[model samples]
Target: MKKRYLVSALLLFSVLSLFIGVTDLTPLDLFSLTEDQAHILWVSRVPRLVSILIAGASISICGLIMQQLTRNKFVSPTTAGTMDSARLGVLVSLMIFTSASPLQKMSIAFLFALLGTFIFMKILDRIKFKDVIFVPLVGLMFGNIISSIATFFAYKNDLIQNMSSWMQGDFSMIMSGRYELMYISIPIMILAYVFANKFTIAGMGEDFSKSLGLNYKTVVNIGLVIVAFVTSSVVLTVGMIPFLGLIIPNIVSIYQGDHLKKNLPHTALLGALFVLFCDIIGRIVIFPYELSISLTVGVIGSGIFVYLLLRSKLGSKSNAS
Candidate 1:
């Protein structure tokens, strides 16, 4: 849980990621790399590594912010319909802008993501039965509806093949020209860190924040926007990573407490490290083949999520008894 340890692990995994591809570019080859090795290192491997780091950190932070704003340990972009809405937006672009560039596609995706997230929050406001677990369950249902609509239209328009890519996250396809869009998350994450304290205060409740002269709605809207933007950019670029955001921030809070500002860096580091570790395992699992980032993260994250669920339920039962 120490910052130094997380930093060390992230660096080590990042280094290993650089050299552990189908291509034979070990540390030994770094000294006298052939042109093809250098090209692969620069073009494919490094870009994949960079996208993993940024995407991991950004999404984890996005989840942390969402959890804070909603005052729920389980709320995250994946659970909150944010990513699903973005996927629908991407499907729309594919059907409409048959030759759209990545940026243009992301722009449309971002708007829909933001809208879907806003609607989810509004529904949360209207709902009176907000058990800690109930909120994200609602979000999951909301996401499924959006996903179903996307699938229906995709099937009719014959864009299901294009729509399928963003359904799961993968880093293998990220080359230099292909992955630059992921960098958009970097600044958005920095902005999250900058407003961390305000978010923390805002999380206390709209009334509490307003009593302190903070514009509670403004802060919450900003948080939603950041979540949507990061979610859309990551989905458009690398596809939907399962629960990287959901589990990482909760794991961090168990040891680090609930201070959003204090936990930002650690959350970011561990997220990046966790993703890198999963990615390395995915690459080497089949020796010459790969497992894709979404699959690896999904298996491991789902296990952790189950643990979190059981812990919460048992804790509640103990308190009641």
Candidate 2:
């Protein structure tokens, strides 16, 4: 019932996002668009909308898979150092392949992200932390360390401003040529859906999964690879939009339960809708001037995160009592 409501809300927001932009486009303008207006709608607005939907859905689904595999609700690309590592990979690409094409940069970034995520998984294996909260805190610290290193390099190479610009997560620049890299996430998301059952079983702990004859390590590696690839593609194409992954999956799981197969579609839908809603609010809140998707999602997602934290705390207290 709640899922239905959320889906409906998401659809409404997506439509609004399509029409509401810096340009003077409304429901009335769609029918009689000037060439310029038509160009803007087709080249800019449509691409931005598509990027937002693909990026949001991909990241949130990645987070859901990570959480299930790790058996921790708080584990996500942002929270688990995956995004930071990918960002570092982007920096490396810029430095090493200064003359490389965008496609080349993306390939290098994807490789680096894959390596970094693998390292994070190894770290998870070595850690003794049994509590869920402690796990994410560890990830936070790990991400910060990587981010710090990336910032240092950006500053030294006189790319700090460029890196900062990329980090802001804006949809305003989503014209046709610039935003196509985001389409890469669509196939990756489908791959995730295909392997949904393996991920769920793997999340049940290595011993249990192995007892059932599932290849736990292989399944986990596949999940991590998908996460790294999706995260890198989105980061390269759209910059970093924080907390969409963490918040969207958590919200979906509340209503749909944790079955990965069942919740995957809901997660993807809610994520797309959530980003579209945020993009629409961003477009209209200041009229011609707009907030970046990162800013809007950050403020809103923080509130939701706080609420989840409180709910978890309360649930724990009740259990103790």
Candidate 3:
């Protein structure tokens, strides 16, 4: 994947996305725009496009960071209970702080997500075997436990409907004011880039990093903070986009190698491209009625994940032979 190819594809999809909707707007409408058409373009489509781009890119990079820090290809916010914890935080906010603003809710979600991620890492430290497949299975179980707790609370509070909304990732409701919190990811992305080298060093191993005078704990903490904050913001704004973080980086790593700085740009581009492609499919598949982004991505990403597992198994057998 060349940068130019990804950029070109992204632009083409973005233009197409701008023109897609129940309300008819076309390429020609750009030149001779009616008030209604212009409003629709500015208010709904553009913001949705922005949200998709930010959420996709941010989550993918967060996955890359996690995989690096944990040295597990499958580790991600989706697998590691970060999103579940954030959802629990959302439920908590609704239950305890009923009138909390979106930012406040996200703040609470961030704390829970951060805590969940830390706990998962501690679990990793205690595990004896640490098989590639086994690690993520544990994460999946951990996440399910957190999700069940959230669901139980939702049922008790009669907020199950509200909880279900955040469970499914959708872009249909995105508009200018509603999607701005995702902009927080931009600065976080920049921070990830700046600390990319340190993260790479930390990923090598804590002993190796300390041998090189790098503060392994600090870099790892920064990486988790970046992951947690971005995950919470995206979950609150766009809902839980599973596997965006898990698969994109692995795909990039297959072609590009594992160096964090080297793979960052490619990971971000492919993440956005994959999400844009999925969003397009969701919109057109039902014509007027759209499927949620979560459904489309989950269906496709899970297939890719299976393929990766099979490939890993085959490679291991070949090496043994």
Candidate 4:
């Protein structure tokens, strides 16, 4: 999609989001704001909008980076065990450091996410077949194993109720104090942009990278670090938004080509636009009650994922024939 069109849509939705909720607030009320309306606008709706945009854009870009580094369309935080490991990290924080602050919890989660993503990449290296369809399935299985461990520990420690919060993405509780940690992703995103070409080169594979005098291992580590940090931040702030990092980049790649730098803007915009659209649907569909962001994104993203899989399968068949 055109950048102008995406920008316009994003702005329109942002305005609509600010005015939407159980409380009666609108553009006209901006001038004659009641105390309650002002509180709602500043305290709740604005933060939720900001979180949605950041989480969506960042996670989507994280997905793009992983796909590039691993040379697989379907590999993402959801598929690669990054988010699950982050959740496990969160569990670790809760169990071991019961009184840990949010930032500390996020730190712990980031470490585990980094380790988990590294392991997945190692597993990717050993796989003999490396089929497109099979790769993410392997990741899914790996993630489930981590998740199962987290669940087992959560149950044993009587933290299952606490752990459930991070299992699904929700924006209902986001507010000024609660959502600040997500700003960590802003700098991370900029860092990703700076290294975009390096990532693209690394994506070409180690032999090609070394032929061009690139430090293949360092670049790959940097890319993995970026993915892990973003995944942990979003998972900590918003919860596990499955299929986001997987699908958005794939969609962008279809129209924008495989150039990482060129596609960054579109991926970020499209990701934000998608999450905003889903958030709007969740708010209005149940009218007052709301669906979690994970539920809406999962339902929609899974459908898109299936379409991509089928498209890839058909393309491969046609090429063979």
Candidate 5:
């Protein structure tokens, strides 16, 4: 997809997003905004829009780097246990920190997310049977184990209700002050762009990158750090937006090919557009009522995930034939 078209679509959807909530602000209101309307626009609508775009773009790019480094299409924070571990980290904060500030909680989550992702990478290295789908299937199981532990901890601590809030991805609660932590993803994403070529080189396998004078472990660790930071920030800020990372990168790779640097922007734009579309649908599907983002994205993203799996399988069969 062309950059211009993506930007145009993003701008259009962003405008529409500002107008879609419970309030009745419109483009015409730009000319004559009362104090109440302006307050709502800045404190609610604008922040929501900004956070949506940033969260979408950051998580999708994180997925791209993960897939590149692991050389697996099905691996992402969602699939690879990173998010679950981050959630567990939040639970740990509640149990230990008790009166932890948001920043403190996020710090704990970031560490757990990083540790979980590292373990997943270690599993990838140890297992020689990394089938196209098998790696992420393992990751899914690993995530389930972490989620179960988090759930158990929540039950023991009587924090199940609090933990459940972060389990569901929702933008309905995101306001100006609550979402600034996600800004951390901006610099991490820029670093991802800067390391794009090294990631590409690393994905070719350790020996190949080493032959080129690259320290494969260092580059891979950097990529994982970036992934962990972005994952933790988005989960902490927006809860869990399932499958935004997995499906967007695959869709972009089909038409755009696998050039990491080139595909980064398209992946980011497509992610924002998709999240905006889902948010709009969630808001309008039942009028004043709403579907959580987790539900909407899960349904649509899983459909696409299945399609990608089948398509890959069929392509393999045809090639064999």
Candidate 6:
């Protein structure tokens, strides 16, 4: 019941996004689009909408899988250092493959992202604490170490301006040619769907999964690969849109429980909706002048993060009492 309502709300917001941009595009403009109007609709509005939807859904679902595999609700690409590692790879590309194409940069970013996420999982293996909250803190510290290194190099090369642009998430520049790299996430999302059961079982812990004859390590490696690929693609193309991953999955799980298969679609839907809502708000908040999606999501997501923290604390107290 809740899922249906959320899905409906998402659809409504998506339609609203099409009509509410700075350009005076009405419902009539969509139907009887002149060549110039068609160009605006195709080159600007449609692609932007698609990018937001893909970016939102892919990151959220990736985060959901990460949390499940680690048995930690707080784990995500942003929290777990996967994104920072990928950014490091991007920085390396800028340093070494200075003239490389975006595709080439994406390849390096994917490699580093995989390496970073693998290292994070290894760190998880070493950690004695099984508390969900503590795990992401460790990941954040780990990510900060890599970020500091990236910042050092970026500053040295006078690439801080370029790097800063990449770090901040903005959807306003998403025209037709620029945003197509995000299509890579579609196949990766499909792969995640295909491996959904394996991920769910693997999340139960290595010993339990192995007892059931599942190759736990292999399943985990596969999940990590998907996460790295998706994170790199989104981050490289759209910049870092934080908390889409953390918030969407957590919300879905609240109503749908932790069953990966059941919650996956809802996570994707809510992610798209959340990003759309934020993007629309960013567009209209200052009218013609727009806020970046990252800033909008950051402010809103941080507030939600605080609320969730309080709710979790209260729930713990209630349970104890």
Please provide, for model 3 over 178-219, each residue's C-alpha lDDT reduced to its tens digit, 9 standing for 90 to 100.
Answer: 999999999999999999999999999999999999999999
Q: Which stretches of candidate 3 lie over 4 Å from their true place?
A: none
lDDT of 4: 0.94
Following a full C-alpha superposition, what root-mean-square deviation does model 1 have from the true structure?
A: 0.9
Total backbone clashes of candidate 3, pairs 3 or more residues apart or in separate chains? 0
Off by over 4 Å in 5: none
The C-alpha TM-scores of every prediction are 0.98, 0.96, 0.99, 0.99, 0.98, 0.97
RMSD of 5: 0.8
Better of 3 and 6 by TM-score: 3
1-321: candidate 2 lDDT, tens digit per residue: 466786788777777777876677787888789998999889987888888889889999999998998888888998888888888888888888788777777887778778777877788888886576888888889888988999999999998987886578888888899988888888888999999999999999999999999999999999999999998888888888888889888998888888999999899988888888888888779988999999999999999999988888898899999
Clashing pairs in 2: none
Tens-digit lDDT track for model 4 on 1-321? Answer: 789999999999999999889999979999999999989999999999999999989999999999999999989999999999999999999999999999999999999999999999999999999999899999999999999999999999999998999998999999989999999999999999999999999999999999999999999999999998988888888899988999999999998899999999899999999999999998999988999999999999989999999999999999999
Clashes of each: 0, 0, 0, 0, 0, 0
Off by over 4 Å in 1: none
- Local distance difference test scores for all models: 0.93, 0.86, 0.95, 0.94, 0.92, 0.90
In the range 1-321, model 6's lDDT, one tens digit per residue, is 477887899888888887877668888777688887788888988899999999999999999999999998888898999999988999999999999898899999999999999999999999997676789899999999999999999999988987887689999999999999999999899899999999999999999999999999999999999999999988889898887788778878888899998888889888988999999999999998999999999999989877777877788789989
Model 4: how far residue 125 lies from native, Å: 0.5
- Which is superior by lDDT, 1 or 5? 1
